[model samples]
Target: MIHSVANTDWQLASTAPLLRRGLCSLAQPLVSQTQRASRFVFAEPTIQLIVSGQLDLSTVHHHITMPASDALLFIQPHTCADIGNFRSIFLSISHSVVETLPRGFANTQTTQSISKSDSPFSTLALDADLSSALQYVISAIEDSQMSEARLRLRLQDLLMALAEKGNTFHNGNPETTTAKLRAMISEEPSKHWTAQSAGKALAMSPATLRRRLAEENTRFEHLLVDIRMHHAMMLFQTTNWHLSRIAEACGYRSTVRFNERFQERFGAVV
Candidate 1:
């Protein structure tokens, strides 16, 4: 039998197999016009289903508009801004769960294919079959009486259904070189990042990095400023760190310069 437990922050439920792997499915109701933005660094990949309403997600390189009844793969860490109130179900897949799959499983193949793809993110429209399976998983997760073995079976079925939709998940090319570089820089915004230093970190020559970023309609200094400013905005919203501290954390030595740049980027005083 499936079981559900309610909590203050979210409606939480689990399957035995998934629980053993430290994965719990969650559903949350979003209020209309409630905007939330955060930086996410996922330790493992996740599959997110929009159960109701619509939301927009923005990364440094991609802006995705997810409508209701759609599914998207979040394979790496990025910043997400929810555009409006929307309800969502999140299936947090652990690394161990992937290891447990059979070598020849199509889900395994899909995972491998995605890892090899140029971009780590993709979205797919759920067909009738996949949609039905997702609804089942969502129901089973919310049902408190659902047994671990049964939930595991349901989860397996969902994976199989996804595999049947060949190339459904591998729907996009890899991110551009500049995007990758920007992700790296975002990971450590406090670092003293320069064209030469960033290029060295990405195993490219400084000149090549500059040229490629230019090809992507960005310059090194511009990209660096954008990254730093984004993080600064995040800090300002989420933390009470003083201006000097925030500036230092964003790799700015001069508070005056940091404030000037912040104002220019955000069109307001920091």
Candidate 2:
């Protein structure tokens, strides 16, 4: 039966699963704007769904802009990055979480029009129930007692709920104009890359690119920002490089611009 829940934070109940194969895990609201700028890097891949506000991301050749009602995914770890200005609440899971994904939901979708390869890993966003499930898990965590076993069980429930939601999200909307836009963003995410470059590469005229992206509920600059933010985060979490060096590696011509962009995108990095 579904457990009635309230907003709360709890110490996990179990360590058995964690001990068997400990997975790095940390889930919290993006703490501060500067942590947003910090080089505090993650040791593995992570994904976040913004419940509110805007987020900026930078990557190899592009920048990504992430808005509310949308999700941001990071598949691999990179060096040097920052989070832009935006107050957002999100959940983060480590690389190991991918192992728990159901089999049929795991393949890459290749039919994207603008982006020839790679797209939002999720073919469809989770349903309202899934969103509620996640919210419940966080709330449950807060209310859970300090028993280790109980904590593990709660976490398992959370993970299972998400997987179920993902399956539903995928089957419900196998096609969307937004899917094409997200796929394109996944492919290149360039800040300097304009709508023109995007259209030319996709074989659409400038006007058509604008129209198509709008129809999908997005803009070119936003996608570029999301791309950049994702890349920057990879660098921040995985590398031992200095902040300035990392920023340079991510494409900022100057450290100052990188810092500003990082906070502008992710908020103080924690």
Candidate 3:
């Protein structure tokens, strides 16, 4: 099913759906709001693409929302929405495969999730190439019904996307403690991530990175949260996986805790 709404003066958003390998699914919908989305529960993981406009996901969970150029990957854990505008292409994936995502690569993002202050994640933004990937995923869903093999190949390509941070943010090898910190979040989006754990990976103490980011006007906790959100978004956008795996892959000791904290932060749930 394709759902979209827009005016003759503007390009309306739209989407489609497909089942692949009996293991995954693809869905796209261009929601222009005009109305509030009903509260519903999904039993599969999902990849959401924001083709244009904005989405106000005010009730799924903790402040969870994405706008133009932003996308979200949602695992099938029961979810309920208060209200939202469908301004993007939303894909519903499978929780089983989503759980297969290696912990080494969970939280991936093209644009950073910035906070109220001049934080780094806040500065990140989506570009054309990344947008192309979203389009490809949508197209695959539209035609995926024709062949399982084709859909599998396309899905592989989509998975690679999670590891890339985009040329726009490319700055050569991230070899220092900061880069190592990034790897922990992007490479192992989950696994009980903490300031101390991150420090240990970089062969330093938690106190060290905390001090380092502090010198640069940041904190270990803040950076850690950014990494979590980043990968969470990637998980929501790429694979049709489960919420349990998404939480653990991203380092939550408990899936329930993961959902609670995630909703608390993003203001939505999946």
56-107 in candidate 3: lDDT tens per residue? 5544234455665543433223334443554444554443344444454534
Q: Which stretches in model 2 have alpha-carbon errors above 4 Å?
A: 1-40, 70-80, 95-126, 144-270
Clashes of each: 12, 62, 42
Candidate 1 stretches greater than 4 Å from native: 1-21, 69-85, 107-112, 167-270
Highest-scoring model, lDDT = 1
Model 1 lDDT-worst window of ten: 1-10
Scored against the true structure, residue 155 in model 3 reaches a CA lDDT of 56
- Deviation (Å) of 219 in candidate 3: 46
Error of 2 at 148 (Å): 4.3
Candidates ranked, most accurate by lDDT first: 1, 3, 2
| Arranged by TM-score, best first | 1, 3, 2
Per-prediction TM-score: 0.48, 0.39, 0.40
**In candidate 1, what are the lDDT values of residues 1-270, reduced to their tens digit?**
212211112232431112223333343434344544444333244566665566566556666777764355444433243333455555644333444544566666666776586554567766567667766776776666788677666766776676666432332224577667765776678898988998998899999998888888889998788788866765654345699998998999999999998878766576
- The window of 10 residues in a row where model 2 has the poorest summed lDDT is 14-23
